[model samples]
Target chain A: MNGLLIAIKSETFIALRTFASKLIVAAPALVAAAQLLLVRLTEAGQQARDSLLGGSNFEADVANNAYGFFVDSLSTGLTMLGLLLVAQAAYSYSYERDIGSIRHILIRRVSRRSLLSAKLIHLHVLALLSVLLLLVSSYLLSGMLWEYSAIVEDGFELISESEIREEITLGIQLALLPLPAAIAFGLLISVSAQSATQAVSTALGITLAIDIFKGLLGGSGPLSLCEFPAFPDRPVLFTIRQSHSARLFRCIDR
Target chain B: MQALSVTGLNKKYGSFAVLDDLNLQIDKGSIHGLVGLNGSGKTTTIECILGLQEFNSGSITALGYPPPQLHLSKGRLVAIFDSPSLHPNLTVRQCLEHALLLCEKPKRSTEDVETLLGISRFRDFKIKNLSLGNKRRASIAQALLGDPEFIVLDEPFNGLDAEGVDDVLELIRTLNRDQGTTFLLCSHQLPYLEQICSHIAILHKGKISHSDTINNLLGNTQTILQLKTAETEAASKVLETISGAELIDIDTDGYLNIRISGADSIAINQAMVENKIPVAELILKRASLAGLFREITSEDA
Candidate 1:
């Protein structure tokens, strides 16, 4: 048990540090900052319409309208996370090859299974942490903006606390669920790839294919590979002022 | 006891046969030096023994466990390769720590390894930042972590300076002596291998051409002799005492160059002294591996 934990810790630490060490926590933070900008935009739109377009209901339109930008930012951040997985895994394997580290590892008492497992698990943890940080930041910044607008005057329907929390939680969960698939895909590519460029380009190419297939598959159905659609229906990550928001929040809470 | 036994191992990469009918037996507690020319399949053999390469046919038993049942020999068989195979993005400390964590046995504290390898200065430095020699040392340190029963090192001295070589050689000696460690060292450097390895296996064209105790193998092989004698007639007479000795035609300069297998300098010296032949100078030269390799391969061709 101790050895396993140590292995897990070492694997995770190396993976996280490798990704974080480069450019130093800037990319994910930048993504979060962009989402915050969207929040600010939504807040400004709400403020301008409070007097003319009615108070609470107008705020709902503002938040609902900003959903597209939020989804875009989150998707971009996820894409970056995917890039991180592909790059780190590819670099990890290729650099090990160059340095003869693979020989060293193979000659050790460790099983090939453990080595491969540690790598996949490590990469997943790193990707998860980056996603979590981005999601947390985006939610907090956007929530703060929504709260600030609530201070001036009551809109048609102010977002309740529980509703905000549920949306944030669900949004994060939704973003995180696809990550395992991405990591598994990345690992499959990394193992077979001889070079980092080959690994990254291949992984990106596959992601693009999935995106294209997802676009071609149209419907409220899950993004199955075969159901090719033209455009995706965006999920509203957060809601604003609506007259029945409290009741809706209560129903969702139940 | 045999530390490793490989028989009829065959491997092919696409159409190229990397290892064919390769057979070797390394005795426990002996340093077995594996020698070959470039593309002679030394690395491939090591990789096969280490269970890193999939063999097409044949069997390998290392430290009493068959491979690719390599997990059974986990922590018992370890190897280091020519390329200092380590994660470059990892600090020397991180590499060690991770390697330790991965080993079957609990890893010893890093302090001992750090001190032994004199890598304290670069413990915090990433592998890419360390010089080649330091990386090699770190690799050795990592290989030694599990107190393995057998170690296979491929061209470990390739990038080391004299001091680094001495340091590594000393460490290898200590490990073998203190722990009863068996080593299969692959190298093109014969002189260096002669110093450390008790047994030698010579590979040519993906086959084991010769394998024997280093001394016996060297003893039976012929050596080139470059001699300058004061009296060519007396030297020839003295040399006649040694059987199987041949005189290559001398140049305009009366240099008595002979190829001899059956005799050493002492025998010739005794014969000269006994026969009242005045001996001005006698030189016995050791043949390098390249000479032996060429002789073996060209004869095959």
Candidate 2:
């Protein structure tokens, strides 16, 4: 137990002084913010074109809700974050081994198992911070670009604001479920690899392979569960967007 | 008490053996040098001893702890590898502070070790930006944060200049004298080892060919005298009458190579003068660790 604490302290000491950990924590938020900005600019151009033609559509306004864009930004950010986490986790161990730094910690006071556990914990902490930053930045940027409101068509309320929030919350929870598994998988590849370059390349390669083949597997097994949260075409993001549209269509039919 | 012990150790890679029934024991407060050829498994032995790799068959103990459990010693055992095993991106000061995290009871501050290693000016420099010698200095500085009872160094003097080597030798002497620290140094630099190490172990043919005090090992080796004389026949006859002198060979350079056990150079010169043999040149080659190592390693070749 004492050895484990010392290992964690050493890991934290290095992470605080290094740039890779900071990249892992901040890169996702920056990319997500850039994505939100691009989408807002495109939407404003479409609005200006519509106004010039004097053709104002109610459905267009409904489709431009903040919730949808927020979900989209989350998807983009999570996709990048997923890859970054895997690459970072894979690089962490093998890079240290390549430089032969791990031998000192192993011979000094920390055991092999303790050092591995500390790395796992450190990666998870970085993931958590990244997710929090992603959530806050996406939420703020989406709200700034568009108004958060219910789906209303011809003065008839289709979905309430609380219902939209609950559905989006559920979508985000489902998207975040597979991240820990991704980190663990990367670390597994790290320890087995012969060099840092091989570890990072192999881990990213295997992850991409799984992501590409997930649809062919019918999305039924455990492997697909790990792939759902990280890819851009994930079902949870689309479900939230489609559920809003489906509700408005059902009310129109009634 | 023995600081480290390896008994009947056997390690093999597939079908080839690297260490076969190798045994070595290092007493506390003594500096032991492990000398071997390029492919003699010096690094492999250090790795197995530190639990960095697994051995096929062996029973090794360092500071009363097995290789896997060496961590239980709580910063009592440390090793400086051939390559400076440090984070390349971290500054020298940051590396020392990071090493302090592993020291249960740090005996020296970051400033202390940096100054001791003469790397105070390079404290803020990144390890990758420093020269190989300064990188090694930073590596050694980190290892000295704690008062380690047993320290293992592999190729400790690979990159250092003359001054750096002298500083390290002085540090080792002070630690072994004041703190009673035990060191196991594995290096190819035989002359440096002879100057710093109190005991020597020669690893040859997958086993220790010689292991003893520096005096015992070098004292047992006979000195060689290269005698060049105008009257070679007369010199050979006079050398045969000497009690401890034996003529080994006459080289192509017309110099008589004589192996002397208990005879002095002056006595041989006097005998040559009494026999009317004028000596042109005479050279005395004293026994050294390098010479002894060459003799032991070349026996099978």
Candidate 3:
């Protein structure tokens, strides 16, 4: 127990002073904010063209809902976060080993098992912080760009605000289930690989390969066990929006 | 008390033996030097002792703990490796502060070690930006933060300049004298080891061929006295009369090389003059660690 604590302290000391840890925590949030800004600019341009042509805004209610954009931004941020966590976890152990710094802690106060456990715990903490920031930034930016309300048509509510919130919540829960598994896979590669470069490249490569395999199987088969959490093809919110949008279009035709 | 002991240790890699039935014992509060050639298993032995790697069969103990359990000693054991094993991105001060986290009770502050190692000016410099010698200085500085009972240094003098070497040697002496700290240094620099080590162990062919105090090992080899004279036969006859001198051979340089055990050069030269032999040049070559090491290693070669 004492050895483990010392190892944690040592890991924290280096993490606080290093750049890689900061990169892992902040990069996802920054990228996600940039993505949301770009998306809003594109939407504004489209709205201008439609107004100039005097086109009918039949789908404007659904399109203008901030929930959809929030979910999209969350997906983008989560995808980047997942990759960053894996790469950082893979780099942490192997880089210390390559530099021979791990030997000092091993000989002085920490066992091999304790050192590895501390790293695992430290990476998980970074993941948690990154997720919190991603949630906050994406929620705030999406709300600023559009209104958070229900989908309505001609003074009659088609979808309630509570229903939209429920779908978005379900979609986010499904997207976050696979993150811990990703972090564990990265640590496993870190200990087994020979060098830091080899560990990172191999971990990222195997993760991407699994993602590709998951796609080829059409989200079915044993490959789904290692599914990429972000950017799911049919999130609950997207499915609900599509179903309602199609119903409204049919009503207009009638 | 023995600080470290390795008995009948055998380590083999894919049927190739790296260390075969090796045995060594280092007493507490003594600086022991392990010297060997490039391919010798010096580094491997240190790694196995530190529990960084496993050996096939061995019984090793350090500071009342096995290699795997050395960490339980709570910073009683430290090691400075050949390469500077520090984070390149961190400043020297930051690296020391990180090391302090592993120490159960640090004895010296970061500033103290930096000043002791003459690296106070480079405290804020990143390890990667420092010169190799300064990087090595920083590496040594971190090890001194804890009050270690036993320290292991591999190639401690590899990248140091002459002044840096002097500082390290002085530091080792001061620590050993003041705190009674033991050290096991593995290096190829024979002269530096001779200067600092109280005992020397020559690792040859996967085993310790010789292990003894410096005086005892060098005492086994006889000093050579070279004499140059126009009358080689007359000089040879006079040297035969000396009790402790045995004429080995007259080398191609026309100098009679005699191995003397107890006879001094003055006595030999005085006897040569009394015998009416005009000695042009008389040179006495004392036995050194290098000479004794050569004599031992060359025997098998």
Candidate 4:
């Protein structure tokens, strides 16, 4: 049990302090920011229609508006979670070896099986935390901006409450479905790797290949969404919003 | 019961034989010294004894049980390598904690072990930041943690200062006296081993060239007597009356050194007392491991 704890702590430390964690957080936030910028440019025609038109109106457009901010936030959150698994699972085995901790561990009475299990558990926990952080950060950032716009528009109302809940729920599923595969593939790569560099390189390459192949074989015959676990044939964003205006509102709430 | 036993153990690496028909036995409650020149397969033998390496032939038994069945013996046995095998990043406290976790119950205090090794100051320092001597102290502390029934230490005093060496020597003596811990120590430091070990085994070319109890090995080998002679004639006369003593060489300073082959201390005293050749100094010297080693090895070479 002590050995298991040590292994878990080691993984947690690496995930929290390493470059991988930063990338997981940054990639999705950047995507959301770019989407907000593009929406603001397209919405200049709607400025007359929007009573909340102002210098910082883009943030308000998504923030008070449920669908636009929600979808944007959800996509960013799921991508960050996937990236965490991609980074951690890929480098798990080889990292310990490169750091020379493998010698110390193997010499102890702990079995290799327990060590591997502990690593997997640690990785999963970190993945969950990363996902949580991404979701919370995007929601809060979009919420603040949307609330500001609602206040300036003479009232704090922009989108309905039902649409807001639906967008958030759909976002969570979109981020969650790929979790098991990420963990399994990470374990496979980590076990097969002899060093950290090799593990990271191999896992990343394999993840890229699998993702590309999954995309290519996505709609082909038996390889359709029905064959995948919790696979989505159509984007969940479309179902999340009832109308085009609602879709924009949902994306902003995300 | 024998603490450790290895019989006809054979091993090879890529057609090069490392250990060929090697056999060794260490009795319980005995401090055994293993001495060998460089590349004499000492480390390999130690590794094989610890079950770290797979031997091709023969078997090893610890505490009367074969290695495969020696699971219980593992906790009872501990080994200290020639090099300081420690994680450089961990502090001494962390290192001991990790080692103690691996050991069975009846926990020992890390404080006690640290004080015993005189490394309390290094308890919080990372192993990498420590001096070589302190690193050895930490290693020794780890070995002493479980207070195992048997221990194998390889060149333990290599990097220790005199004071540190004495502390270790005293600890080993105390453990041996109080708990009867069987020890198999391999070192080229003959004087240090001579001070503590009861039995000695010298390995040469993957085989034990010589092995015997320290007292027996010393008492059985010939002793060299260095005597200062006032008169060469008188010294020669005095030497002729001594039985079982051969004069090896005489210096220009009138020093007569003769080899006495047996444990007859009284015969030499009587002869010298009778001769009364103005005896300046009468010293009986035992053959050291170094002299014996050079003679045995060069003769073979």
| Candidate with the greatest lDDT versus the true structure | 2
**lDDT of all predictions:** 0.68, 0.88, 0.85, 0.67
Q: Distance (Å) between predicted and true CA of B8, model 4?
A: 2.3
Off by over 4 Å in 4: A1-254, B64-74, B226-241, B249-257, B263-284
Give me the displacement of residue A188 in model 1, in angstroms.
1.0
Best-to-worst TM-score order: 2, 3, 1, 4
Clashes of each: 18, 0, 0, 23
**Tens digit of per-residue lDDT, candidate 4, span B1-301:** 8898888888888798877888788999999998887888888888777655678898888776565433344357777777677766678988787667556553468998898888898898988899989988988788777758888888889899999999989988999999999999988888888899999887877677677898877766667887775666777776777677778888776677788875354676667677775667777766876666666667778
Docking class of 1: acceptable
Give the Å error, residue A193, model 1: 1.5
Prediction 3 TM-score vs. true: 0.94
- Model 3, span B49-140: residue lDDT tens: 99998999989999989999999998899999999999999999999999988888999999999999999999999999999999999999
* Per-residue lDDT over A145-248 for candidate 1, one digit per residue giving the tens place of the 0 to 100 score: 43322111234445544554565456556555655666676677777887767876877676666666554555533434111111123222222111223443
Q: Per-model TM-score of chain A alone?
A: 0.65, 0.90, 0.87, 0.65
Model 3 clash tally? 0
**Winning model by DockQ:** 2
Interface RMSD of each: 2.6, 0.6, 0.6, 5.6
Kindly give the stretch of ten consecutive residues in candidate 2 chain A with the minimal lDDT sum: A245-254
lDDT of 1: 0.68
Off by over 4 Å in 2: A219-223, A226-229, A232-236, A239-254
